[model samples]
Target: MPHDENSTAGRVATQERIETLEADTEIPAPDLDTRPPSSGATRQANDDLRSLEAGLDRLQTDPEHAPRAWQRFTTSVLPPILFVLALIAAWQLYVVIAQPRPDIVPGPLDVLAAMSQAWESGRLQTAVLTSLERGVVGFLIAVVVGTPLGLLLAEVKPLRRAVGPIISGLQVLPSVAWVPAAILWFGLTDATVYFVVLMGATPSIVNGLIAGVEQVPPQLRRVGTVLGAGRTRLATLVVLPAALPGYVAGLKQGWAFSWRSLMAAEIIAVGGTIGFGLGSMLQQSRELADIGGVLAAVLVILFIGILIELVFFAPLERRMLRRRGLLGGTR
Candidate 1:
C-alpha cells in the first residue's frame, strides 16, 4: 500500500508540470525521438545552392551582342551626318537670307560650283595630293625620329629629369614660331617645310612615347627579368609591346602637329617654284577675291584630317584596347 501511493504521487507530479508548461507558454511539446537527420538538412542546403548556381549560369549565358545595323546607323552614323547636313543648311540659309558680301563669305552653291570648276581643271587634285603628301611624309618622319627619343626619355630617369620639361615646353611653342628658324636653317624649299614639320611634331610624339613607356607595369619588367630576359629582349618582348597603345596615341597627336606645321610653312613661305598646295590655293583665292574657292579649300583640309583619323587611328586604337580587354563590351 505504501509503494503504490508513492508511485501515484510521482506520476501526478509529472502530469502537473507538463500541464503548467503548456498552459503558460501555449507551446507544443517536441517529440525527442523524431528529429530530422543531419544529412536531410545538408541536402536541403545543397539544393538551395544549386538553384543559385543555375541563376548565375543563366546570367553568363545570356548574349549581349553588338547593336543591330539599323540601330548603329541611327546612333552612330546619323548624328554626325545630321550635324554636317545641318551645318551645310545653315550656311546656305545664311547666304540666301543675309547674302553676306561675296568677297567675305561665299554662298554654299557658289562654293560647290567653285569646287566643280577646280575639279574639272585638275588643279584641285594636284593641290590636295601635294598637301597630303607633305603631311604624310612629315608625320612619318616625326614618328621615326620621336619614338626612340621618347622611349629613352621615359625609361631613363636622368634623361626625363633633364629634358622632360623641355619636351612639354616645345609642345606649347607655336609651330608657326618654328617657321622663321626652319627657313633660316633649310632655305625656302621643301626642306624648310619638312624641317618645320619635324620641329613641331617630334616633341609631341616623343612626349607621348615617354609617357607610355613610363606607364609600363614595373611588375611586368620584374617578371621578364626573373624569366632571364636580357635588356634588349625585355624591351622588345615586354616594354615595346606593352607601351604600344600609348605610342599609337602619340602618333596621332604628332600627325596633328605635322599637319599644322606644314600649313604654316606653306602659307608663310609662299612664292617659289614649287607647285600649289591647299594652303597656297587658299592664299591665291583670297588675292583673287574668290571666297567660294577659299571655303572649298578649307572643307578639303577638314576632310583630309577626318579621313586620316577615322581610316587609321580609330581602328588601331580600338584594336589595342580590345587586346587588353578594356574595350571588350564597348563596341
Candidate 2:
C-alpha cells in the first residue's frame, strides 16, 4: 500500500512540473489586426531596395546607356579611315622622293587616273561585279559543303583522326598551287575558278569547325545529355552556339582563301567561257605593261576585301561577342 502511494505521488509531481514548464514556455499567437505598422526606416530601406533594382533593370534595357552612333563611327570607322589616309600619304611621299619610273612603279595619282578611266568606260564596274559574283558563289558553295563535313568530322573521332591532318595540310597549301590542276580538270572556265576556290576554302572551314568543337567544354556536353537532348539537338542547340566564335573565324578565313583561289584561277585560266574579272583585268594590265592599271586593279581588290570585312564579318563577330557578354561595352 505504501509503495503504490509513493508511485502515484511521483507521477503527480512529474505531471505538475511538465505543466509548469509548458506554461512558462508558451508563446502567444500574433494578432494581425492589432499589429503596429512598420517603422519609417524599414519602409525607407524597402524603397531604397526597389529603387536599386529599378536602376539595375534600366541599365540592362536602356538604349541611352549604349554607345551612341557617332561614338561607334569614331571608334570603329574613323581609325581605319585615318590609317588608309596615312598609308596613301606615305605612298605619295615615297613617289615624290624617289620619282620611280611610271612603268616600274606608277604614282598614286597615276593609279587613280587609270581607275577613273576604267570606271568611265564601265570596265571597272564589270570586273568588280564579276569577281564579286564568283567569290560569293564559291564561298556559299564552300559553306554548304563544309558545314556538314565539318560537323561529321568533329563528331566522329576515327574520321577526324584519319582526315584532320590532311585538312590542316590543305589549309597551309597555297591557293595558287591548285590553279594548274583545277584548270586541267575543269578547263579554262568558271568551273576551274570555283574548283580552286573550293579546294582552298573547304579545308579552312572544316578545320575551323573542328577546332570549335574541340574547344567546347566537356561539362556542357554532359549537361546537354542530362537535359535529355539527342545527339543532333545537343550539337545544334548547345555545341554550335558555344562554338560560334571559332566557326565565325573559320568562315572569315575560308572567304579569304576562296577569294585568293578565285583570283589565281582567273589569272591562270584566262580564256574559255570565263567572264572578265578583276584577276583577268590585272593579267591584261600586266600583259600590256600598264603599271598604273595593275596598281588600280590591286587597289580595287584590296578595297573589296576591306569592305567585306567591315560590312559583314566585323559586325557579325561584334554582335556575337556582345550577346555572350564578351565584348567590353554596349554599342
Candidate 3:
C-alpha cells in the first residue's frame, strides 16, 4: 500500500515539474510569411548576378599572363614568311652554286631586275590592273549566279538529284577545256573570256553552297520553323549563317577559277586592248626567250594571287571561323 502511494506521488511530481517548465518558457510567435518574387524579378536578379560575375572575370583577366597577339603572330604569321624566305634563299643559293643556264632557270637577281624594268616601263601595273579588273568582274558575276543556284539545289530534293552530278563533274573539269569552245562561240572577245570564267567558277561556287546548306543541322531548321520563320527567312538567317564556312570556301574557289580563266584568255586571245594582261606578258617573254622576264611575270602572277588571298579572303575566313568558335578557344 505504501509503495503504490509513493509511485503515484512521484508521477504527480513529474507532471507538475513539466507543466511549470512549459509555463516559464515563452513560445515564439511565427513571423508573417513573405511572398516569393515573381518570375520576372527572379530572372532579373539572376541576370544581375551573371553580369556581376562576368565583370569580375573580365577584371581578373585584364592583365594577361601571355601575349596573345605576339604568340599568334609568331605562330601563325611569322612561320609562313620565314618558310617562304627560306625557299627563296635556297633557290638563290642553287642558282649561284650551279650556274645553270639563264634560259633554264634565271637567278633571283635577274628576276628582280626584270620586274624593276617592267615596273619602270609601266607594263607591270597595266597588266596587273587589266587582269584584276577582269577577275573582279568575272568573280562578281559568279557570286551573283552561284549563291541562289546553290540554295535552290540544296533546298529542292529533285533539283539536287538531277543536277548534283553535273555540278560535281563541272568542278573537276578544267577551265582550259572551255577556252576552245568559248573562243569558237564568242571569237576572241571579252565575251569569250567572261563565258569561260563563268563556266569554270559558277559550278564550284554552286557545289560549295549546296554542300554547306545540305550540311546545316536539321535541328536548327526545326528550331527556326518553331520560331515562326518562313522558308525564305530561315534560309537567309539561319541556314546561310551556319553554312558560312562552306560559302567562303566557294567564293575562294570561284576567285581561283576566274583567275585561271582570265589567264587562259589573256594568253590565247592576245592583240586586242581587252586581251592585254600578265598572261600576254608571259607569252611574249617566252616567245622572245627572255627567261628573266618570264620568271618575273610568273612571280607577279603568284604575288597578286597571294596578295588577294591575304588581304581579302584570309581575314574573311579567319573571322568566320572565330565567330563559329572553331578558332577561338584553346584547342
Candidate 4:
C-alpha cells in the first residue's frame, strides 16, 4: 500500500514539472486581428508607392497638363522655320561679304528668281509630280515585297542564315552602284529606276523585320502557343504588333533609300522617254552652268523630303508610340 502511494506521488510530481516547462517555453499565438508596427523604411516605401500611383492617375486624367494642338504645332514648326531663316540670312551675308561670282555661288535671291522662272515654265511642278509618283509606286512595291520577305527570313532560320549576310551587304552597297546594272538590264527606262529602288529598299526592310522578330520575348511565343495559336496566327497577331516599332523604323529608312536611288537613276539614266524628275532638273542646271537653278532644284528636293516627314512619318510614329503608352508627357 505504501509503495503504491509513493508511485502515485512521483507521477503527480512529474506531470506538474512538465506543465511548468511547457508554460515557460511556449510561444504566444500571433494575433490575427492586430498587425505588427511598420518600420520607418516600410512606411516610406508605402508612401512612395502611393505617390507614384497618384501621379500616374493624375497624368491619365488631367488634360491641362497635356500640350494643346496649337502648342504642339508651334513647337514643331517654329524651330525649323527659325533655323531656315537664319540659314538664308547667313547665305545672303556670305554672298555680300565674299562678292563671289553669281555663276559660282548665287545669292538666295538669285536662287529664288531661278525658282520663279522654273515655276513659271511649269517645269518645277512636272519634276516634283513625276518624282513623287515614281517614289510612291516604288515604295509601295517595296513594302509589299519586303514585309513578306522579312517575315520569312525572321521565321526560317536556315533561310536567314543563308541570306542574312547577303541582305546586309546589299544594304551597305550604294544604291547608285546598282544604277549601271539596272540601266543595262532595263535600258534607260522607268523600270531601271524602280529596279534600283527595290534593290536599295528591300534589304533594309527585311533586316528590320528580322531584328524585330529577334527582339520578341520567348514568353510571348509560349503564351501564344498555350492559347492555341498556330504559327501563322502567333506571328501575325502577336509578333507583328510587337515588332511594329522596328518595322516602322525600317519603312522610314526604306523610303529614304528609295528616294535616293530614284534620284541617282534619274540623273544617270537620261536621254530616254522617261519623265524629267528633280534629279534630271538638277543635272540639266549643272550642265547649263546655272548655279542658281542647281541650288533651287536642291532646295526643292530638301523641301519635299521635309514635307513628307512632317505630313506622314512623324504623325504615324507619334500615334503608334502614344497608342502603346511609350510616349509620355506632352510630345
- Candidate 4 lDDT over 284-321, as tens digits, reads 99999999999999999888877887899988988898
For model 4, what is the error of residue 286's alpha carbon versus the real structure, in angstroms, after optimal superposition? 0.7
- Per-residue lDDT tens digits of candidate 1, residues 1-331? 4545665775555554443322325544465247653588877998899999999999888565755779867866799999999999999899899978987888888889999999999889998999999999988888889988887887789989999999899999988897788777777788888888898999989987887787899999999999999999998899998888788888889988888888778878876554588888888887887888988988888898888998899879977887686675745
Positional deviation of residue 53's Cα in model 3 after best superposition, in angstroms: 9.3
lDDT (10s digit) by residue, model 3, range 66-135: 3388777887789899999999899999999999998888888899999999999999888998889888
Q: Lowest lDDT 10-mer window, candidate 1?
A: 16-25
Better of 1 and 4 by TM-score: 4
Clash tally, candidates in order: 0, 0, 0, 0
Alpha-carbon error at 75 in model 3, in Å?
1.5
Residue pairs that clash (backbone atoms under 3 angstroms), model 3: none
Query: Which regions in candidate 3 have their CA more than 4 angstroms from the true location?
Result: 1-67, 328-331
- Candidate with more favorable, higher lDDT: 2 or 3: 2
lDDT of 2 by residue, 178-239 (tens): 88877788887888888889988999899889998999999999999999999999999999
Q: How much lDDT does each candidate structure score?
A: 0.83, 0.88, 0.84, 0.88
Pairing residues by index, what is the TM-score of model 1? 0.78
